[model samples]
Target chain A: MKKINFSAGPAILPASVLTQAAAAVENLDGSGLSILEISHRSDAFDAVLVEAEQLVRELLNVGDEYGVLFLSGGASTQFFFTAMNLLNPEETAGYLDTGSWSAKAIKEAKNFGKVNIIASSKESNYDHIPRGYTVPDGLKYVHLTSNNTIFGTQFKEWPETDAPLVADMSSDIFSRRIPLEKFGIIYAGAQKNLGPAGATLVIVRKDLLGKVNRTLPSMLDYRVHIDGGSTYNTPPVYPIYVMMLTLRWIKAQGGLEGMEKHNERKAKLLYEEIDRNPKFRGTVADDFSRSQMNVTFVCTDEADTAAFQAAAEAAGCDGITGHRSVGGFRASIYNSMPYEGVETLVRVMREFE
Target chain B: MKKINFSAGPAILPASVLTQAAAAVENLDGSGLSILEISHRSDAFDAVLVEAEQLVRELLNVGDEYGVLFLSGGASTQFFFTAMNLLNPEETAGYLDTGSWSAKAIKEAKNFGKVNIIASSKESNYDHIPRGYTVPDGLKYVHLTSNNTIFGTQFKEWPETDAPLVADMSSDIFSRRIPLEKFGIIYAGAQKNLGPAGATLVIVRKDLLGKVNRTLPSMLDYRVHIDGGSTYNTPPVYPIYVMMLTLRWIKAQGGLEGMEKHNERKAKLLYEEIDRNPKFRGTVADDFSRSQMNVTFVCTDEADTAAFQAAAEAAGCDGITGHRSVGGFRASIYNSMPYEGVETLVRVMREFE
Candidate 1:
């Protein structure tokens, strides 16, 4: 049976991409060498790095002022790296504590400089995006988790701020179109909508670097990677190659606009079933703030939760269980989750009801 | 024609491992989902992580006193991380300047603490490992690059020092056994003898941590990864899986002892040919210091270099070209490069002569 994977991360990639990647693993483009054995400095891998960067730019409409870097150590590393490069000891950066990821980012940023919490929805268990928070001037940058995978809340609108906006878009990077000009830095782990778990996609405004007074580690510094073209050392070659394949798949899907429509349709189908089915109810406090990527919901009667889970598993639905902290269900309909997969889940919910 | 790959770091892996890894990329052990799509927290992946750690402990004879961690950002990140976690700003560490990599490691260590160059071969262009340096008491640790990939030299004997030995064993780990008791920490990027380019294998003594006074970034701090079981933040999933597969292959081939004998035989075959063929001459000054993993040599006549390269290419021998700095040839016959592959390279060298 073909399992419907709703894994929050290290999530579903396009089937075609997986097939091609598998083939490349054995013999890359009939070059008689496995992709795993290729050197990062070789012309073949240089092409991969260049094409991946170009695809990111074309798909995201990234400007020339920004440098697209495919780096190792996921978004978790970027949490502190962003601050380390841009935030000085005397400067302060504003962060919105919307969910667990944002909170962790705040914790790391505080190590480098002063981190001011602009607003927080933590009191409500991060059930919605915090609103009406005044953005203070003189901040180094305003940071936020654009999409929270844990609580299933996403920022529907940009927070009004003059400081360069830094966002961790790990779960929903390619799912929708964004205002590229508004972001000074946008970093995402490749597992969610991109490709796999090893590579991190970082888009940074080149002008935003070199202001910090502290000495930066070569690997941690964005300038070093940008200058080296993301090959300062041996990069995650396999992951970057897989990402390139995923990017090609995205381009075939008519770029981000097509992905937005596809993802929105899937989210609408699943959310409607959650609302209509008597056994279920959505978890987020506000419908407007609910994530279009990870749709979290729960059974109205706690007893039905276990029954529904068993049925879903039997029906070949995998990874629908919510995080341990949330304890319900999270159907992560990322860019590659076909509409039919969501339809299958809705059918299961309807049957349970 | 199947090429004999000798690329250094991001080098060749066992053929069977490549086939199995390729199969897993599409569907991991009939799980009905691609390995690239599985969650790291899933039981399937948990088994992989556990087994990989066990293999390391068994093969390396790692005791419970140390932590076996799989991290991201490669060994380049560890150049600074080791110093940040072990060396304080006021303390000093000894570093043996052997090759380009060791030079870089020394440069990064200088950022965190006082560095003493105990011995250096930089004046000799790193053609040999410096020796006879007396170790001073009270130094934090003595750092060395076990195998100098760029210059084709290796340390045959460890220095006498009370301080813990921190080795950057990026090029030759898993190819041979070592006295694990002498080293406080051993880190290697999984691009050479291990697996691919993303995951970094770090074995650190538990007591060595928490000695540094500086507040560490969670990502750079080894303790964070150790405590998190190396899943601190979505580890390079595919890379770790590939490494696990490679580890399994290593075990099947008689563990470290079997690997050492196999590697030694391959090195001997190629080195014997290089010494016999009047067209070639070994680059390392000391015969005992010549690396068994990477056999570097040059054409006796400079003009014959391009001719040998063309002949090697025509015969389907890949990655034999040496580093541009050295400007000769580097036949990196890592553990995975079968005896037959080295035989083919030897044939090419003989034909060139």
Candidate 2:
């Protein structure tokens, strides 16, 4: 059966991207060499890297003042690298821990320097994003996850703070419009919205560097990657190439503006099916919930949630399984997810009812 | 038109593994979901994780006393994390700087504690692995890279050190029989020798845990990964799955002993071609050179090299383009490189002569 997929990340890539990626895997650029076969430093792969970074800058409205990087290790590596780069020895960095990922990032930051939990919603089991976190003036940088992919919440409006802002936009990047100038840095793992799990995408304002007190390793040195174009060392080549293909797909789908509308509509349709149907209910509080991405909801009977999932699968919708940490169903509507896929999911929900 | 791949990393994977990976990408486990669609926490992926970990132990001849971890970041992250976990803030550790990767590891170590380069080949520009370096007494551990991918060198044997030893076997893990008992730890990024770049294999002796001065991030802490089963967070799932398939392929090729024979023959065939044919000469010393993988050689006539590369490509020997830093040809004859491929290369070499 043709499946409508809702995987959170490494989720759904556009057919064109997949076709291009598959062909590139065998023979990239008609060079008789697989994309995996080319050297990272070769002009062949250099074009891939330059164009990939250029796409990130163009799609996100980032300026040349920002250094866009693609490096190995996922955003999980960034959780610590960002901390090491930004946090001075004596100063404490502030973190707003909204869910599992932000919590991971905050945990990594504590190892480098003094870490202050500005605010967190884990007390409420991450049902909502923290509202009243105070970003201290003397803090090194305030780290926040723009969207909680697991907990089904988002910071609809970002906190306006004097401290340099570092956002882990792993799950929410390219899903909407944002003022790129406000943040000192933004990092994401490409698996969610961009491509695969091997490479991490980092965009840092060039000015925020050089203040780090700790001796950074070449791997941890954002400056090294910025200078070497994220290929200072051999990077995960195939992953970055897929990311380029993904970006191409996103652009062909009408770029960032088109993606926002697509994701918003997919998420809304799925959530509407859940909320309006008697058999199911939405998980998060309505006003604070997210739309340009994941939709989490549950069936009336927890046991029957499995039945709902089975029905959805039988009806050709896939990957609607919710996180075990937060039960029920989660439909992750990333950039490549067609509205028709969401409609199929909605129809699955009605059939289950 | 067949292609013979020798790309340094993201290198050649077994044909069976690629076929399986392609099918898995389309439909994982008959669940009608792509392997990319499933959560790392799902029972299906968890099975893959367990199998990958188990295969590491089986292949390495590591007993139950050791902890095997599959992490997302490359060996670069583990370089510091290893130092962070093993070194106390007040103490000094020993490092043997052979080539590029070891230098990076040494830099990451300085962030945690004092580091002494017990020996270095920097004066030689890393053309060889350093010799005559004895382990310093009272040092936390001795660190070395078993093989240098870029420089095309490998350590033939390790030091009989009183201090515990740690090796970044990133480019040469599983290439031959390792003295598993000699080192407290051995880590490799799974690209050249293992599988792909995203997943890192860290095998650590259990007694060396919990010695660092600072608090640990769950991801950075070796103990955390051990305790949480390396599923500490959403891992690089697809990469891990690919590694699992590669391991299976390795076993099917008669495990490490078979792999050793296969690699030895391939390297011998290529090295024989480079040595006898006046056209080509090896970069590393014959006695201490890598026998199992990464054979880099130069042609006597510079003008003949590009023409030779084109001729080799037409003859189905590809990815033979040498690294830019070390110009000429580098054939990374890792385990997946079929004997037939090497035979074809040898035939081409004979024609060159």
Candidate 3:
């Protein structure tokens, strides 16, 4: 049976993307060389890089002011790199601490500059997005995680902030459209809604760079990568190539607008089941902040958690176990997760009830 | 005809490894989940990471003192990271400048501390490794590029020093047995002999860390990664998985000793042809310093370069063109290049002559 993979990140990719990527690993588009063996400097891979960048622009409605870079080190590296490039020691940056990833970003930013926790839901176990915080003047940028993969919460509405918004949208990027002009930077690891792991997708507004006083390392500097066309060094080639294919897949599925609707339908189906079924309850406190990507819930009877998990696994649902910090279940239905997979989970819940 | 790929790093991998990787991409070990979709936290990938580290220990004879980490950002990132963790701003490190990569490393290292160029072959176009340079006293570490990919030169002997030797063995790692005891750090990007691009193999001495006073970011700190077991963040999953498979293949072919013999055979076959054939001349000035992995050579008649390149391509020899800095040919016969591939190249050289 085809396993319904609900892995939070490094989660399910489109079946067709996997099939095409598999073939390319052996022989990329009949080029007689495995994608694994091709040089990043080769004309063939240059085309792949170019097309992938183009697809991001088309899908995200990006402009000339922003540079699209497929980098390495995942979002974890970006946690420091963004601050290293954007924030100075004397400068202060405001961050909205929604969940685990947000807290991490804040921690790293403190290494480079002053980080103010504008608002935080951590006191409440991050079950809801904190609201009604004042956006302080003279802040370099306002940072936030668009979605909390662990807490199963998301920023349904953008915080009204005049500071150029820098987001670590590791889990929710490309799933929906956003006001691109409102942000100075948007970075994500390529495990969710993108391709596989390794490649980090960074879209940075060019003007915001070169303003920081610190001398940045070449790999961490956005300008060096932008100038090198993301070939600054041998990029994560295989991941970028897979990302190009995934982006091509995204374009074919009608871009982000299409992805938003597709994701919404799946989220609605699963969330309704969690609410309606007495056997299960949603983890997040607020309905508005509930994530469309990762649907988290727990059994009404805590002891029944293990039995329900075994039942889900038997029905081909895998990686549904929640994070250790937040114990329950989290069904991560990213862009490629078919609606039928969610339907199967809903049916399993109904049967269990 | 199957093309004989000889592109430098992001070079060839074993054909069987590629085949296995392709299959796993579709469904990993019959788990009904594509390897691309599997979580980094899953037991499936944990096993992959554990086995890969074990294989490194077995192959390199790594002791408990050394901590093997599969990191991201490639060798380019490590150029600064090593210096950041090892050298205080007051400290000085010695570096051997051999080629482009070495020079780049030197440039990055200077940002962290005082870097002394212990020896350099740059004046002579780096055609030979510098010899007889005194290892200055009180140096934090003596860094060197084990193999100069662009200039086709390699260190025939290690410099006599008590300072822990740090090597960027990007191209020649795993091609032969090394003096692992002398080195404090050994890092290689996983494009050449390992598997693919994205994941970087970092082997660091545990005792050498935490001595530096600099407050290290979580991503750059070697100790943090060691504690996380290379799972500090989501590593380049697919590349690490492919590397594990490649390492497994290496063991099957009889470890590092077996690889050294295989590489020597390939190198001897082509180097002999270059020396005897009037049409070709080896690039390295010192015969002993010539790299076994990248056998770079030039045509005696410069005008014949274009015609020879075209003819080789027609005969299914791809990626033979040399680095743009040094125009000629570079047959990068990394571990995976079959012995038959070299024989075919020899036949091509004879035909061209």
Report the alpha-carbon TM-score of model 3 versus the true structure.
0.99
The DockQ of each candidate is: 0.90, 0.41, 0.88
Clashes of 1: 0
What TM-score does model 2 achieve against the real structure? 0.91
Clash-forming residue pairs, model 1? none
Q: In model 2, which residue pairs have backbone atoms overlapping below 3 Å?
A: B190-B196
Considering summed lDDT, which 10 consecutive residues are worst modelled in model 3 chain B? B1-10
Indicate the fraction of true inter-chain contacts that candidate 2 also forms.
0.35
- For candidate 2, lDDT tens digit of each residue in B1-353? 64778777768878767667766666676866666556666788889988998898898888978899988667877788889899987898889888778888998888888999988877866777767656768888899888888778888878767777899988788878877888899998887777766788899988899766677656678887888798766677777888899898888888888888998888888887788999888877654755457888888888889888988888988788887767898888888889998898888878987
Task: Please give, for residues B1-353, the per-residue lDDT of candidate 3 as tens digits.
Answer: 55789889798888889899999999999999999989999999999999999999999999999999999889999999999999988899999999999999999999999999999999988989988779988999999999988889988799999999999999899989899999999999989989899999999999999988878999999999999999999999999999999999999999999999999999999999999999999999978899999989999999989988888888888899899888899989999999998998899899999
TM-score of each: 0.99, 0.91, 0.99
Tens-place lDDT digits, model 1, residues A1-353: 77999999999999999999999999999999999998899889999988999999999999899999999899999999999999999899999999999999999999999999999999999999988889999999999999999999999999898899999999999889999999999999999999999999999999999999999989889999999999999999999999999999999999999999998899999988888888999999998889999999998999888899999998889999998878899989999999899888888888888
The complex in candidate 1 yields a DockQ of 0.90
Better of 2 and 3 by DockQ: 3
Candidate 1: which docking quality band? high
Could you list the CA RMSD of all candidates, in the order they appear? 0.8, 2.9, 0.8
Interface DockQ of candidate 3: 0.88
Summarize candidate 3's per-residue lDDT along A245-268 as a digit string, tens digits: 999998899899999999999999
